[model samples]
Target: MIIVGEEWEELAAALSQADAPQRVYVVGATNSGKTTLCRYLADETATHTRTAYVDCDTGQSRIGPPTTEGMVVHSRPPDPPGRAYLRFVGSTSPGGHFLQTLTGAKRLVEKAAELSAGATIIDSPGLVFGGVGVEFQFQMIDLLRPTQIVALQHGRELERLLANFARHPEVAVRRIPVSPAAVARTVTERRRYREERFTAYFADGLSQEIPLRGLGLQGRVPDLKDPHGVERRLVSFNDPENFALALGIVEEIHPRRRALTVFAPPFDPAAVASVRFGSLYLDLDADPGSMESSRP
Candidate 1:
C-alpha cells in the first residue's frame, strides 16, 4: 500500500482547488515516491478535470513498457494501468539520448492535449544525481512549462532544483517527503525488469523483413565502417506522421539486398515509414549478461 504524510494531502487539496491545473510535472530522485504520488494525483486530479498521465521514466514505467515515454488519457481516474500512446526513446537512459527523451515527452504531451485533456501529469525518471541530470531536467522544465512542479525529496537533496524553480515565480513548486514504502532497486533488478517487459511485449513476435529502399533509417547506423555489431539491437518502426507502431529486434542486415530481418510484433508492413535503432543490443531469449558490454 502507498502511504504519504501531511504533504500528500496538502498537494492534493492545492491541485483540487477551484482552478484545476492544465499541466503538472512531478520530479524526484531515485526511490522517491514520484510514481506513487503521480498515480494518486492522476486519480484525484481527474475528479476536477479530464486527466492524462505521461510516463517519462524509461526504467520503471507504469503507463507503457520501458524505453518509451507514453501517455494515458482518461475521462475518470486511471485504472488497471490502461494502454498508452508511446514514443520510443531508443535507449533507457536519458544522458545519452537527452534529445530523444525530451523530444518524445514534448510530442506526447502535445498529443495528449490534442485529445482535449484538461490536465496532463508528467512522471519523470530518477536521474537527479549529476551535472547531466541537472541540465536535462532544467531543459525539461523549460519545455513543459507546467502549472506546478510537485517535487518529492528525501531531504534537502533536491533543494537545488526547488531553488531553481523559486527564481521563476510563474512555476509553483511543492516540496514533499518521499514515502518510506518506496523501494530502491539494484542495477541487476533493473535489467531484469526490462527483460520481463521485453519478453511480454514480444511474446508472439515474428521475424519479418522490410526492403530498405524507401524506409528511412535513424539512430546509430550500426557503425557503417565496423558493421561487426548488428544483431539483437532494438529498432522502432514509426509511421509517416512519426507515430511509433512497434519495436523489433534486428536479426540480420542485408547490405546487398538492402533489407533487414527483424523479430517484432505484427504491424502492417505498408505503414512502416521510418526505422530508428537503439544503442543497446539484447538477446532476450538468452541468459542475462552484462548489458553494458552489449552496447557498442
Candidate 2:
C-alpha cells in the first residue's frame, strides 16, 4: 500500500479543482516520496476520468523496466494496470543520454495526450543537482510544459531549478516537504533492484538471429572489427516509426552473416526496423556493466 500524509490533500484538492486536462509533473530528490505521491494522484484522478501515469524515472521505473520511459493509461483505478507503452532511453541514467532521455519522455507524454487522458501524471528521476542535473531538469520542464509541477524537497535543494519556473504564468509550482516516512535506499539495494528488473524482463527470452542488412543501427554501434564486443550488451528493437518493440541482449554478432543473435522476450522479429544498442551489459549473475560512449 502507498503511504501519503495530509500534505498531499491540498495537492489532491488542487487537481480536483481543475476540469480541464491536467499534466502534473512530480519532482524530488531520491527517496523523497515522488513515486508514492504519483501513485496516489494517478489513482485519485483515474477514479474520475482517464488518467495516464508516465514513468520517467528510468532507474527505478514502475511501469516498465529500467532504461525506458513507460506510460500506462487508466480509465479507472489502476489496481492491475495494463501493459506499458515504452520508449527506450538506452541508459539507466540521463546524464550521458540527455537527448534520448528527453526524446523518450516527450514521446510518451505526447502519446498520453493522444490517448485523450484527462490527467497525465509524470514521475521524474532523482537527477536534480549539479550542473548537468540542473540543466537536464530545466530542459525537461521546458520540453514537457506540464500544467502543474509538484516539488517534494527536503529543504531548498530544488529551489535552484524550480526558481526558474516560478514566474511562468502557464505552469503552477507546488512545493511540499519531503515526507518524514521517506527512506533512502542504499546503492546496493538500487543495484539489486535493477538486476531483478533485468532478470525478470528477460526471464522468458529466446535467442533469435535478426539480419542487420536493412535495419537502422543506433547508439553504440558495435565495431565490426571487434565481433565479440557487442556480446551481453542491452539493446532495443524498434519498429518502423522508432517505437521500441522490445528490449534484447546481444548474444552474438556474426560479421560474415551480417546478423545479430539477440536474447529477448517474445516479439515479432519482422517488426524490428532498427536496433539501438545500449551502454549497459547485463550478466544476470552479477552487477550490470557499463561502456562509456557517445549518445545515439
Candidate 3:
C-alpha cells in the first residue's frame, strides 16, 4: 500500500529501514536553477548510498537525450552500485513543447521507480504556458508523490504557481522569497554604478531618435500595413511605463496565480552551485576512500 499524509517522518523511517532510496522532484520556471539545485542535492546524498538524477525537461534537456527504445526497467545499466541519470528528449519534436516535457516526466518517474534508486531527484521545466503547464504539474504530483518538492520562481510567475499547488494534498510547498539583503545589495551596487556613469552621460544631454518615412514616397496604397514598420516599432524597454504595460499585457493574456507566500529568500545560484555532493574528504570517522560528489 502507498503511504500518505503528515507521515513524512514515518515515510523516511520506512525508507531508511528499506533498501531503496527516497525520491524528490525539483520543479520551477525556466532559468530558476532547478537543475543546478538537483545536481547538488543528489551529489550530497550519494555518499554511503547510491543516487540518481533524472532530467524531465525534454523540450530543452539539460543533461542528455531522452531514453527511447527501452522499457522503464531496461533504461538503467544492468549492474549493481550504479548511478543512472535519466533524461527524456523527444526525437520527433512533434506536439507542443510542454506536452512533450510532461510525457517525458512520466516516463522518467516510472524509470526511477523501476531502478529502485536509493534516491532520485527530478528537475522539471518552467511552468508558464497555460493548459500544458497545469496538466504537467498535476500529472507529476499524481505519479511521483515526491517526498519533497523544491520550486523556484522569478518575476511575476510565483503567484500563479502558488494558487495552483495550494490545492494539492501531497505537496509541502514553501516560497523562496527574494532576499532583503539582495535587494539592498542591488540598490547599493546600482547606486554606485549610477553615480559613476549616469552623471557624465546625462550631463552631456540625451534624447531618443525616432525616424519617420514619408508615405507619399512609398506610395500609400489607400491602406497598407507594413510588417517591417510594425516590427521596428515594437515595444521600447528604456521606459519604465512601457515595461509595466508589457507586464500587464502578459497578465491579461495569462492570468496570474491567486495565492502568494513570503518564505525563504530567492535561491542564490552561486551558493547552490557551490554545494557539492561528493568531494575530496577523509571520512576518518568511518569508511575510507569514500568521496562525496554532486553538481553545480
Who wins the lDDT comparison?
2
In model 1, which regions exceed 4 Å deviation?
Answer: 18-21, 77-83, 223-227, 289-293
lDDT for each of the candidates? 0.79, 0.84, 0.38
lDDT of 3 by residue, 18-112 (tens): 46456666666655556556555554455434556766653334343221111122122233434333322222121344443455466656666
Stretches of candidate 2 off by over 4 Å are 78-82, 287-296
Per-residue lDDT of 44 in model 1 = 78
Which window of 10 residues has the lowest lDDT sum in candidate 1? 287-296
**Per-residue error (Å), model 2, residue 186:** 0.5
**TM-score ranking from best to worst?**
2, 1, 3
Provide the TM-score for each candidate, comma-separated.
0.91, 0.93, 0.43
